[model samples]
Each structure stands twice: as C-alpha cells, then as structure tokens.
Target: MKKIIEIKDFTKSFGSQTAVDNLSFDVYEGDIFAFLGSNGSGKTTTIRCLLDIYTPDSGTLHLFGRPYEFSMSKDIGYLPEERGIYTRSRVIDLFVYFGNLRGISTKDALDNAHQYLERVGLIEHKDKQVSQLSSGMQQKVQVGLALQHHPRLLLLDEPFKGLDPLNRQLFIEMFKELKEQGVTIVYSTHVIDEAQRLTDRLVIINDGKRKAYGTTEEVRKTHGSEHIHLEFTGKFPKRSELYTSVSTTKTAEIIPNKGVDPEEILQELLASDLRIISFRIDLPSLNEVFIALSKDE
Candidate 1:
C-alpha cells in the first residue's frame, strides 16, 4: 500500500518546553491508523502541525507522498478534539458550510448532510441551532461535516469523546465502513480498548517521544508482558518466576518466562490443587503498555 502520512524527526516546542520530540512514523493508505497518548503527550500539537494550524519548531511532514501545503487541505478532513461551531447557525447550515470549504456545492452538501444525519439518528436535529444542541450532539454534527466532501484522508482527534455508548458504537461502525471504501484515516485518541480493537497500526507517544509504533499487537508485544489470566475453582499456587501476580483467589496473571510458553504454565496449573474454570491469554492493552513505557521515560 502507498504511504498516506509521514513524519520524520518531527519536533515542536513552545517557549521552554518541547511538545513533540524526534517523532518518526508512517501511515499507509487505506489503513485505520491511530496516534495515541495521554493529555500532555503532544497528540493535539502534532495534529495541529499536520493541519497547518501550528508551525513546528523542526522536522518534516508529508501527506499523499508530497510535502504538506495549504492548498492540499481540500483532500483532507479534520474533526478536532475541541469542537468549534457557530452557535447561532443551524446544525445543517454548519455542515453545509464545512462542505463548501472543501469545494462542495450547497445543494450537494445539504443532500449529503441529510444522509449523514439519518445515519447518525440526528436527522430531526438538522434544523436546530448549534446553541440548542448538547456538546455530544454538536460533536455528532462535526462528524457529519467531516464527511461532507468524502475526503481521502480523515484526521480525527478524540473522535469518540463525549459520545454515549450507542453513539460511540455508531461512530465506530461509520469509520469501519469508511475504511472499507478505501479512505485513509489517522485518528488520535487516549482511550486504549477501542483503539486496540479497531486500528490496523498505531503509534503510542509519551512526553513527546515515540514510545511504541507498529501494528497494535506488535506494539503491545514489544512494550509489555502478555498475561495468562487464570480463574480457578480452588486455592492459587505459591509460584515464582513465570507466575507474575495474582489479583484474587481465582484470578492471576502469569508472565511467560524467556522461552517458556504460556501453555507450560497452564500445564503446571492443570496438575495443581485448583480446578481450572478459565484459561485465557490476555494480551496487554495499549493503556497498559503506555503506563509501563511512560514510567520508564
């Protein structure tokens, strides 16, 4: 696949503090990529630099195999973490206006927005003013607008924030559909579980540094230990080495030692006093990896 986004030694700073430091990564075309980090980890700063809203102190960025230019923005769509809406305008108008900025006509924008509203279950709220809508509703509107011109590259920052469970699932389904159509998406989010489940590849940065990068499984495997979580029917064993930690009577995390397979631990448990009720390998979530790497940093 062609590379859709590239950042090499991308550095950005404000006054005495560096926001991003020596970051390098690639997002391939048609990939559902994730940029993940905590609040002060340069997720938004790096996004702004890509959007031309902030000039970086150093480094380079490329979109669609070329150096980023303001004129090239029409090919990209952005839904920022901080939602922006003209409070006085109707929800439909805002979406149409956003579409207009991306070179879509009023009639097409409205038609498209209507379809999106229908999908988001917010069709009735189209005529309502932005001020009348809740932040979550406004967020839904922003998502509709981002799809106005059917951008080739969608850049979303905290896209699932402020959404209820149903709406969150709706958005996830929406993005999954977009990916199937071959749209390249790079989304920034701190939430780990959802990212772990959906992303094709991800980069986890902490304190403005690249802590981990690659496919979700690859990054997690590289940074943190995988746990064989066991729930037994009796007392746990007094074990060492590969037997890492226990949370309760029936549950524990067993880290495989060097060349020891997780199956070996299960084999040991099978012959122990406890009767096994569950034997499952729990791969470390991205959040787990983040905490481990951040502590080291």
Candidate 2:
C-alpha cells in the first residue's frame, strides 16, 4: 500500500505542556487507519497537526507525499472531534455552502447532500435547522458536509463519539462502503471496540508518545503479551518453572515468559499429575493492551 500520511518525530507543545512528543507513524492508502488513544493522549492534537489546523513545534508531516498546502484541502475531508455545524443554517444548505468551497455548484451540492443524507438515514432531517437536530443528527449532517465533495482522504476525529449504537453502526457501514471504493480513511477515537472493528492499522498514543503502532496484529504482538488460559480438573499450578504471573481460578491464566510456546508448555503439563481439561491461547485485546501500556506511560 502507498503511504497516504506520514508523521516523523512529531512534537507539539501548548504553553509549557507537551501534547505530542516525538510521535511517528504512517497511514497507508485505502486503509481505515485508527488513531487511537485514551482521553488527553494527543489523538486530536496529532490530527490537528496533520490537517495543519495546529502547527507543530518540531517534526515533519506529509499528506499525500507533500507538505501542507491549502489547495490540498479540497481533496481531504475533515470531521473534527467536536462535531459542529452552522446552527442557524438548514442542514442541506450547510452542505451546499461547504461543497461550494470545494468548487461544487449549488445544484450539485444539494444533490450530493440529499444523497448522503439518504445513506445516513437522515434524509427526512435535511431541511431542518442544524440547531433543531439532536446531537447525533447534527453529527450526521457534519459527516454529510465533510463527504459532500467526496474527498479522497477522510480524517474523522472521534467520529463515533456521542453516538448511539444504531447511529454508530450507520457511520461504520458508510465508511466500509467508502473503503470498498478505495477511499483512504483515518479516524481517531478513544473507544477501543469501535477502533478494533473498523480499522486496518492503528497508532495508539499515550502521554504524548507512541505506545503502539502498526497493523492490529503487529501492535498486539509488540505490546500485548501472549498467554495460555488453562482450565484444569484439579490442583491449579500456582508456580511453574515455565510460566510466571499465574492467576488462578476455575480457569487459570498462565503468562509465560516471552518467546515461550504454549505447545511446549502443554507437554510439560501433560507429564505432570495435574488433570488439564482445556487450554487456549489468550491474546490480549486492543483495549487491554492499550490500557496496560497507557498506565505504564
């Protein structure tokens, strides 16, 4: 895949507090890249730097293999973490205005707006004032406007925030369809479940640094410990020469040393007197791995 966005040693500061420090990552073409972090972990700030909404104190950013340029704005659609729209304007009218900025005619913008509204299941609310719509509805409007011009790259900061399950699903479906059409998508969020399901690659920031970065599996393998979950018939092993950090219960968790294979360990258990009923490899979930690394940071 081609590199869509690249940030090299990106650092940003506000007053005296560092928001992002020496962060480096790459977003590939036609990928749904997840910009993941917990609250105040610099997800938004990194995105702002990518969009040139905020300038970095140090480091380099490249979008589409080039430095920041206003002309490129039309090719990149951005939906900020704080989703907002012109409260006084009709939803459809707002789309028209934003589309015009991207050089679309009013007639074309209206057509595009309604088409997007239909996909997002908000066509009935198109003529309503932005202030009158619910927060979720307003979010749909913001997304509609962002996509009005069908930009090649979509940068959505916390796109699923403040959304009900149904509405979130709607955006997920829309994004999947867009991805199928080969549009590169980058969305930032603190919600791990959504990111796990939606993303092809992920970069997780913690305390202004990259805690994890790569394909989900790569990141997991890097920072997430591989473990064996064993359910035994009797005499749970609390201490083993092969495994440490043995957590006991009806089902016990045995965290082996790095590079230890579960299959090799299984042979040892079979040689013992302890009756083993079942065993499975337990790879840490993205949420668990991220929280663990974030806490360490």
Candidate 3:
C-alpha cells in the first residue's frame, strides 16, 4: 500500500516542555487511521506539526511521501480541535465561501453544501445563523465544510466531541462511506469504542511518547490478555492462588495465574456455594488495552 503520510523521529517542544518525543508513524492510503491518546498526551501536537501549524524541533513530517506545501491544501481537508465559524453568517453561506476558497465553483459548492446538510440532518436549518444552532449542529457544519471539496486526505481532531450518540453514529456511517470511496482519514480521538470500530490501524501515545502502534488486531494480541467473565448468584468465591478476580454484585472478571488452567479455575468456582449464571472467556477489549497502556507509571 502507498504511504499517504509519514512522520520520522518527529519531536516538538513548547518552552522547556516537550509536547512530542521522537514519534514516528506512517499512514497508508485509504486507511481509517486512529491517532489515540488521552488529553494532554500530545495527539493534537503531532497533528499540528504534520499540518505545519507548528514546526518540529527535529525530524521530518511528510504528506503524500513528500514535505507538505501550500498547493497540497486543496487535496487535504482539516478539522482542527478548536472550532470556529462565522457566527453571523448563514449555515449554507459559510460552506459556499469556504468551498470557493478551495477552488470549487459557486454552483458546485451550493449543491454540495445542500447535499451535506441534508445528510447531517441540518438542511432544515440551512438558512439559520451559525449562532442560532447548537454546538453539535455547528460541528456538523464544520464537518461538511471540510468535506465539501472532496479532498483525498482528511485530518479530524476530536471530531466526535459534543455529538449525541445518534449523530455520532450518523457521522461514523458517513466516514465509512468516505473510506469506501478511497479517502484516507486520520482522526485523533480518545473515544475508544468508536476507534475500535472505525480504525484499520492505531497508535497510542502517553506523556508525549508512543506506547503502542499497529493494526488493531496486532495491538490487541501484543498487549492484551484473555480473561473470564462470570455472572453468578450468592456469595462469591474467596481469593485463591489459582486466579485473581474483580467483581461487583452478580459479576466477576477473572484472570488465571500463569501456568493455571481456566478449567481448573472454573471447577473451583463450581465447587463453591455460588450459583453460576454465565461464564465466558474473551480477549481484552481495545478499551482495556488503552487504559492499561495509558496508566501512569
């Protein structure tokens, strides 16, 4: 697969504080890539450097296999973490203006704007002033603007912020459609469930350093473990050398000790007075892997 974006030993600093530390990663063409990290962990800082909003202290940031240039802006769509729009302008007007700036004709821009608005459930509010719409509505408008020009690459920073579950799912479907059409998307977010569902590959950062990076399955297999989930009635079993468990009310998650068989643990539990309702063993979810990787040392 072709490389769409590359960062090599990239580092950045603000005063004496380091924001990103020798980070390196590649985004392949047509990939839905997740730039994941908790707040203040330098996800935004890496993106800013990639777009030249901030200069790197060392190393290279490349787009389309080369350094980014102004001419490339037309082929790249960016939705920054800090969002702002013309509050006094009508919703449709803002799209038209930005679309024109991206070299689209007024007629095409207007048609595209209307199409996007309808898809995002905002066509009814097309003529409303930006200030009149809710924050999520404004976010939808910004999303439309970023996509109006049909760019080859999309960079979205915390794009799901403030969106209700339904609206979030709506946009997730749209992104899937875009990916099917061959758009390469790199979005930074801390929302683990969405990332696990939408991303082809991911990188986790903590304290400005890369902690994990690979295809979703690879990361999970490399850093995650399997555990048993149990639902039962009555008193839970006492702590034993066979396994460690965490439980609440009627459920427990058990991690068997090394060299211990899950069957042995289950037998022990069965011998206890508790009535087991259900039991299943599964690999750790991306959320669990994320928490374990990002935890403070």
Candidate 4:
C-alpha cells in the first residue's frame, strides 16, 4: 500500500507548553485512519502541522511522500475543528465558490454543489443564507464544501461535533462510500465507538503522547484485559480477592486477576447457587482500552 501521509518525530509547542510530543505515524492510501484522543492531546496539533498550517518545532510532515506544497491543496480536502463559513452567503453559493477555487469550472462546480447538497439532504435549503440555517445545517454545508472538489485525501478534525446521531450516521455512510471509491480519510475524534467502527487502523494518544496504535482488535489485546460478561439470576457474588467485578441489575462484567482462570471464577459462582443465564469471555473493547490507557501514570 502507498503511504498518503507521513509524520516522523513531529513535535510542536506554544510558548513553554508542548502540544505534540515527538509523534510519528503513517496513513496509507485507501485506509480510513483515525486519530483517537481527548481534546488537547495533540490530535489537532498534529493535523495542523501535517497541513503546514503551523510549523513543527522538529521532524518532518509529508504528504504523498513529500513535503506539502500549495499545489497539493487541490488534492487534499480539510475540514478543520473550527467551523467557519460565509454566514451571509447562500449554501449552494458557498459550495460553488470553494469548488471554483479548487479549479473546477463554473458549470462543473454548480453541478457538483447540487449533487452534494442533495446527498447531504440540504438541497431544499440550497438558496438559504448560512446564517438562516441551524448550526448542524451549517456544518453539513462546510462538509459539502470540503468534498465538492472530490479530493483524493480527506482530513476531518472533530467532524462529529454538533451532529445528532442520525446525521452522524449519515456522514459515516457517506465516508464509507467515499472509501469505496478509493478516497483515503484521516479523522481526529474523541468518539471511541465511532472510531472503532469506522477506522481500519488508529493511534490512541494521551497527554500528547502515543499510548497505543494498531487495528482495533490488536489494541484491545495489547492494552486491554480479558473479562467475562455475565447475564445472571439470583444474588450476585461479592467482590472476591480472585477477581474484580462491575455489575448492574442482572448483568456483570468480571475481570479475573492475573493467573486466575475464568473457569475458576465460573465454578465459584455456580457453587454459590447463582443461576447463570449466559457467560462469555472476551477481550476488552476499544473504549475500555482507551480508558485504561488514559489512566496510566
């Protein structure tokens, strides 16, 4: 696979505070890569440096195997964390303007704008001023503008912000379609489940440092523990020295202590006269891995 973006030993600082600490990662062509981290954990900082919006203190940021240049702007689509659009401009006009700036002809730009607006369910509001639309609606327009030129690489920062679940799902589907069409996407987000579902590979960062990076299953195995999920009846077992358990109404998630067998825990529960409904041992989820890594000292 060809590398679409590369960052090697990239570091950035503002004043005395370091925003990104010697981070390095590669995004492959046609892969949906995710930058998973909480706010202020360097996800946005790394992206800005990648786009050359800010100069890095050290190391290299490359696009298409070379340093980014103004000429490459037409090949990359970026939706920044900060949302800014011409409030007084009509929605369709904003898209057409950006399309033209990307070097598309007026007729082609208008055609693309109409197609995008319809796809995003905003065609009915094509002539409405941006200010007349709600924040979520405005965000849709911004997304359309980023995509109107049909760039090969798409970079989105906090793309899910201000979106409702339905709209989020819509965008997710749109991304999947783009990926199928050979568009590579790199998005930074704090939403763990969405990242797990959408990305082929991801890097989890905390305090501006990489904590875990791999396929979701690989990260779960590397940074997560094995646990038993139980749906049961009767009084639940009390916390035992052999394991730790978190439970609600009729379900419990039990994590055995190191070297303690899950079978041993199951036998003990059965001996206690608890009617087990169902039980299965599984690796922790990406969310669990993220929480555990974030708490690391």
* Prediction-by-prediction clash tally: 0, 0, 0, 0
TM-score of each: 0.92, 0.86, 0.91, 0.94
Per-residue C-alpha lDDT of model 2 across residues 1-297, encoded as one tens digit per residue: 789998999999999999999999999999999988888989899888887889899998999998778778778898888877789988888888888887778888888888888877888988889899988787677778778778899999888878778778888898999999899999988889778878899998887898888998888788878878888876665445678755565677778876778888888778777788888897767887888888895
The candidate that wins on TM-score is 4
- Tens-digit lDDT track for model 4 on 109-186? 889888888877889999999999988888788888888878899999998987888778888998999999999999
Q: Write the per-residue lDDT of candidate 3 for residues 110-210, one digit (tens) a residue.
A: 99888888877899999999999998798788888899788999999998987778768878998999999999999999999989989999999988999
Model 1, runs deviating above 4 Å = 259-261
- For candidate 3, the 10 contiguous residues with the lowest summed lDDT are 161-170
Model 4 segments beyond 4 Å from truth?
A: none
Between candidates 1 and 3, the TM-score winner: 1
Better of 1 and 4 by TM-score: 4
For candidate 2, the per-residue lDDT at 132 reads 91
For each candidate, what is the lDDT? 0.85, 0.85, 0.89, 0.89
Clashing pairs in 1: none
**Residue 82 of model 2: what lDDT?**
83
Error of 3 at 274 (Å): 3.8
